[model samples]
Target: MSFFGELGNPHFRSFEGDIPDNREESIDVEGEGREVVPDATILYTAASFTDRGQVLVEPTGPVLGKAEDAPIDVVGITEGSRVLQINPQETGAEIVVIDIHHTTAQGEEREIAGTASITVGDDGVPTLGSSEPVEQLSTSIAIRGAGAQVAADDHIYLQYSLYEAETGELIDTTWPASPILLDLEGTMEGLQTGIAEAPVGSRLLIQIPAHQAQGTDDLIAIVDILAVHEDEDVDDDMESEPTSTSEPTELSSTEGE
Candidate 1:
């Protein structure tokens, strides 16, 4: 007898009931004496499974502190630590956390936090986790001096040494290779000429052209006129001024003769 017939035949001690001819009817038994009852036709659902070893977690977005990730224990996670949940596919991924500190043009300190992911591409090129955006800096260069003076079409020679502003270390032996020259013409020239004629030891601000600087394109130099020498014609003027007379007059003593 077939296994199905033996299961249902009553006279057969092992199979005590009539076998249901329909192939659809079947009994599903769970743990001992417990039967799973279904309302409709039972359909077995199979789940798709994938094998993943261990996943290492890291910071994903912007990072604030220095700590990178949290320590893993069998029980659970530790407090005050960062944990990164990563996929097994990203086994060798690298994580970077950056804290950017910069000084603005207005002399203000700016602190920022950022994070990035690193991976090796198929062509052996290294790529970031995300696109690295370009950053623009609002900055100004400061040129400091006590005083400056200049005249229209007048040539002002700057005699000073260049040094690193921050470290106060001498950068060049003499003044910068190219001295800042100002052409007192139009609006700017008139303004500078007035400043030049003011006095010695004068301080002034001069805007130089882009091409004149040795390495820089645009710059403003604070000029201090340490000394001034005016051109004078002393030789020709000495003979022109009238001289006082102290000669004795000859009296007419012929009258007495």
Candidate 2:
């Protein structure tokens, strides 16, 4: 018997919608017959109402957030129509605005701050710019709220977003999902040292030099220290568990890809 579940996996089924109008025209639109998933949008061209032979755009896809803010101008199409806003009732998450400064692959320096969406400047391969090269691993607590400080061996919950310090590219984030459980003693050396004495509700910006990260490349992380709890008692059969020395491997996020 096969242990893998690929054979048992179900395929997506489809249904056809009744024709809205008897007026027939060739479906010459882009993304014709493509399936749009949840929290997505699409854009297409159709025969113009007045000039039936000429094509015009309905710009925003019928689905929500489906490339609503896509930079079509990158491809030199500037006159395309677009959606002006997304209703929170339809797109569940509250849009957050954060300031981030990055230098692109073309060496262009840019600052994305203020009213633009958090996912606004995701187009380019950007590196987090720094005036001075990082000499050592560093951690700074941005918000210090009233709470108990984390112990070195404590079991706790953490929410974080990891970025590359030099390129400012986002590698991972744990927002919009449940906070991750961590045992400080089993985490990476840099991470364990970084949050050793941090308190709950603390927000930290950490810069880990290349020598202590996942790869030879330097790493930048923004962490929110959440709740902490004690380990529960376990039976002898499970008591000899080996400590995990591996770096964090699972990435979580509530934000759209």
Candidate 3:
């Protein structure tokens, strides 16, 4: 989603700053001899319309929150001006945006102002931060589940969140639903190495260097090893399945159908 900087070139201009708090700006539009503003065929920014579209926005002051720009995608335009209700999609968890108060290296924890204490709810994605780049791999246990130590033969269920270690911006997560299931041998080397010695139910906060990360970017993850099963069913399924052989099998023309 983008914002508009100017009212004339609605889509062309980039808008920034906080949205007006008091009320939404409304401009007047008449279907008289005035030229029609073109209807937008492509995605327009928040409340922006083309010259061919007769769109009007009322005059309003900055009453919105500290954010100066609107977070929405304007996808439609019409000949007549009307109120457009733009709903911003919540793409990630509700996280407290924090700026580094000072310059420091990774693993350095200091107080940040204007930041709130966040509680990662059940099914909620957790957030983490670092001052600078992660020089080496590190791990901190966030939660220790009750169970035996994880083993290579175990099938592990996990809920994890990966973030950019340098910026602390969240990249991905498996929580609130849809967890990851894997055997130690099938998982990534970084994950396998990090969780190898940890016990089942252990929530690890791991900081990984770019070399160890999947995308070659400094990363940090909060991983919850939910459960570990013996996975005998996997072995059984493999054994029951027929293996491909060099022998050719005859097929009918309508075999697929």
Writing each residue's lDDT as its tens digit, candidate 2 over 51-118 gives 11111221111111122333221121121221111113221311111110001111112333222112
The 10-residue segment with the lowest total lDDT in model 1: 40-49
Better model by TM-score, 1 or 2? 2
TM value for model 2: 0.41
**lDDT (Cα, tens digit) per residue for candidate 3, span 100-120:** 000001122323322211235
TM-score of each: 0.20, 0.41, 0.42
Off by over 4 Å in 1: 1-149, 155-158, 161-198, 205-216, 233-257
lDDT of each: 0.23, 0.39, 0.39
What lDDT is reached at residue 165 by model 1?
25
Clashes of each: 15, 7, 31
- In lDDT terms, how accurate is model 3? 0.39
